[model samples]
Target: MKGRFWPKARLGDVTCVMGTNGVGKTSLLRAISGTHPRSSGDVTFDGKPLGQMNAHKMAQMGVGYVPQGRDIFPLLTVRENLQTGFSCLPKSEHFIPDEIYQLFPVLKEMQTRRGGDLSGGQQQQLAIARALITKPKLLLLDEPTEGIQPNIIQHIGEVIRLLRDRGDMAIVLVEQYFDFAFDLADRIVVLRRGEVIENAAKQDIAREQLLSIVSV
Candidate 1:
């Protein structure tokens, strides 16, 4: 299926994309990230064609993707895993920023710990911190709340809100957790079968209507 995210103007600071499982939510992110080759259609970021670019190029272009399962290098130390984001940066920008630690203090404490040693919540935080290391303009988060503890989920939500409030980047969150998304999104995009079914500002559509659209 073909799809595009050409918002009339700029996308909101936080845009939540929702659909049931197997509805191509992850596929959309993969396409945008250039991680999966598309059969057709061009993807452009800030007027640059992304269809021909590889994942590394996408990252270098300021697109940070935190895929669903928090893919951290198990054998690598927390610090080492975060540094992997440096692959897209210059030598001078190799060091991790103190801001990343501020956003996730647990990561600062676990800097020397192996990625495999951290709890699921900590691992998720590490994954996000790793992506932030690139200082992306577009951040794509997939099911960030999945399998996470409530307290950790709350903390993650706070971090996301803080990021959005910074007014620097656009966040596209793909989530099934309705309450979580509703609370944070400035707009909502609902999809079904690889196609966008509804795209509207969160206030323009009623919650019941949005729920029904996704259920269809």
Candidate 2:
């Protein structure tokens, strides 16, 4: 099955992809982000083919990826981790946007702390903040709430909502938490064994039916 995303080039538009485990969810993100090579199919973004573009190239093309594991540079300070995203931007845009701090004030407070020293929730915030540093046009987030505390999960959801409301970048979220995905998604795509089994707008699909589709 194939899933395509064509952003209206506006902010606050969100596409949520949901599925059971091992259903090629992460593979899809890897292919789009150019982190893993795809043997077939085409990925076109903004009317251009993304053929053979490495992760760096994808980043330069305004794609920001926050992988599932919240991968952070353990030894680096939070500020330094954010600075790494500078490679994707021009020298003039090197500074972190004030909005990032506004979205996650904890990051600013822990600017000098090593990434590994932070708790699970704090690390996740840092991962997301680092991605935002690139000021991407398309943001890919994989399971932002996994392993996080309940309060932090709610906070993460709030941040996602805020990002969407700003309406500058399109967000593609991969989440297994059905309720969370349902709340933020303008549209939902469900997959099974790498096949798209369900695709519809949130209001168009009934809640129970959508749950059954993904469960299958």
- Where in model 1 is the C-alpha error above 4 Å? 1-12
Per-model TM against the reference: 0.95, 0.95
Specify the highest-lDDT model's number: 1
lDDT at residue 195 of model 2 (Cα atoms): 78
lDDT of 1 by residue, 1-216 (tens): 445463421433798989889999998788888888888877778876665778899999999999999999999999999999999999999999999999999999999999999999999999999999999989999999999999999999999999998888889999999999989989888888888778888889999888888777
Give me the displacement of residue 184 in model 2, in angstroms.
0.8
| Model 2 deviation from native, Cα RMSD in Å | 1.9
Poorly placed runs, candidate 2 (over 4 Å)? 2-11
Global lDDT for candidate 1? 0.89
**Candidate 2 residue-wise lDDT, 81-168, digit = tens:** 9999999899999998888888899999999999999999999999999999988889999999898999989999999888898888
C-alpha lDDT (0 to 100) for residue 14 of candidate 1: 91
lDDT of 1 at 118: 93
- Give the per-residue Cα lDDT of candidate 2 at 25: 89
lDDT of 2: 0.88
